[model samples]
Target: MPWDKDASQCAQFDRVFLVLGNHEFYGISREDGLKAANALEVEPQLLGKLSVLNQSRVDINRRVTIIGCTLWSYIPKEYQLWVRMKVADLSRINDWTVENHNTEHLQDVQWLQQEIHNISLEEDRRDLIIVTHHAPSATKTVDPKHKSNPWGSAFCSDLLESQVKSWRGSKIIHHWIFGHTHWNTKFRQHGMIISSNQLGYDSRGSRAPRFFNYWFPQSGQDFVITKTAKV
Candidate 1:
């Protein structure tokens, strides 16, 4: 079961956002029992609700605007079904042609950029929050194995670089929220580029698995981690 909406469990913070993990999609197409349902606490119906929220920009008045990117954007439907069929013992569904896959690449880029641009527009506010599935980039590349985890979308890196440049250039955008690394971290680079720790519900000691609460000041770059509680 997903985490119940106990607002008491979450500390008061400026904003909150979330992203999808590979496990969110791993069992989705075929409805296999994968991990994110528990780790990410995703109930079956609320899966694509993030996209709707991202597009509509709902709940902005509460100092919160959640944006989510779809997981496994790089893989085409045919390949996805092939992998699913292999695991599910079902016949292959070749719905994805090369042309469709190519189209997804372009749309995916636009989707990411649009979200970054939209969130960047929140400059009128004192703080800006960003949410996504994978980590943008590590302050240090400690893990040698993550170099090739298809789960970690490099396309996100490209988008982040552009967003950082835009933020630095326009003086907007500061905090980035993410998951999928299943680790917890709170660090900044050169006084910019910040990321929250992933919830460590799984048995991975990579990062301290905890939820983060950040307080963004109305002025100056004084960002602080207000609270962190283990799940």
Candidate 2:
């Protein structure tokens, strides 16, 4: 188990950035979730070497910049259920404690907004990408079956509608990738290509050899990523 801390396992990828998903915050209650999250906090130096991030940005290979964060989901109503539960099994099994929620604390969202603002001030945009475990825009979070319903949308719609557009300066977000709603969706919105991905998790462990395949998502799909042009 101690070897799990090793970052070399991901040597296959040139860049690796990890973040805490709502799953990390799923527990009996908000207090428990908070404790759970705290327990997940790896040593900062160790996390840096592993390329894990939270409300942070990084320049990879001097070519592209990626920002990562996780936002709380909208309150539970039957409509928001489909969008926030993540997956049917997870919905049924995991207690939904994070929904009554935290985007209002101004901690996560504010940091992301400031990051964008800072990036805008710099002359070099160089392919900026946004990656969060939760959806930010309504257009990206809506349920296809109930597109007209507000409950089927994201928690922080205003942040997407105004806050991002009115930042210090203008910059185009070419791609936005998220996880919470474990669906493989791709569409172009505003001027960016937005998409979401998630690896469905019914259970996590290796007690047996019958969980799921790595290349294929048996629980659903591991998160999806939007591939953009080279900067």
Candidate 3:
């Protein structure tokens, strides 16, 4: 697959951190998602296949502590995927088979809630990075040109406002990076830098991968850099 080639392009970096988006689980059975989550329960080492294995408030490096999950989305009703559960739909359609993608959205928020609270208790450490596939709240979405729509909720989280209001103001996370929106974003809010540098699939053709570079433990002198490679 193209990603195999794409993955190699990232070798220059010291480490790669990731969280699956809803797209990663698309066409995957809910049972498979559960199984994948369970496999980590039995053997956490395998999580390297999914990411750096630092999802659970683990110290990712001397410079950064990371916690992340593929967050769920409460899309606006107008933006939701068309629901279809007709007679063969269950077998043929992937949307219905997503198995409560929206419901899991809140669970992801709670995870951040608890993890951030736990990190707040830490003595002294590197800054934090909050990773999710979906924008936690509308502010994270941040597209004014994006037309106002009641149904566009599919892009960002619904419960994020309720949970993250306190966390954002705390200035605990230095950077928040996510995917799924397919925007090349870099915005600052509440003393945190949120980025969504999507290596997106172009409607006309395949787009290249983009990189965001930063120092391992400390960033200064324009530490963050972006590079793109065409395969």
Considering every candidate listed, which one attains the maximal TM-score?
A: 3
Clashing pairs in 1: 184-197, 185-197, 200-209
C-alpha RMSD by candidate, in order:
10.6, 6.4, 8.8
Give the poorly placed runs of model 1, Cα more than 4 Å off: 1-18, 30-56, 62-64, 71-108, 115-126, 138-156, 167-170, 189-193, 204-231
Report lDDT per candidate.
0.40, 0.55, 0.53
Question: Model 3, 67: alpha-carbon shift in Å?
Answer: 1.2
TM-score of 1: 0.48
Worst 10 residues of 3 by lDDT: 211-220
Using lDDT as the yardstick, the better of models 2 and 3 is: 2
> What's the lDDT of the predicted structure labeled candidate 3?
0.53
Error of 2 at 14 (Å): 3.0
Query: How would you encode candidate 2's per-residue C-alpha lDDT over 1-231 as one tens digit per residue?
Result: 123455454555555667666445443444464444444345443443445457778876554688877654444455555554433323532454334353332577677777877776674555678887767766655444444544434433445665666765436466777765434577876666677655555224442134233312333433434544343
Top candidate by lDDT = 2
lDDT of 1 by residue, 1-231 (tens): 233353223334343333444343432331332233333334433442322222223445445444454322344444554434322212221243334434544564566556656655655443444555545554332133444544333223444444445443223344556554444556655334456553334332323223211111111122234644211
Reference-based lDDT, residue 39, model 2: 45
The clash number for model 2 is: 8
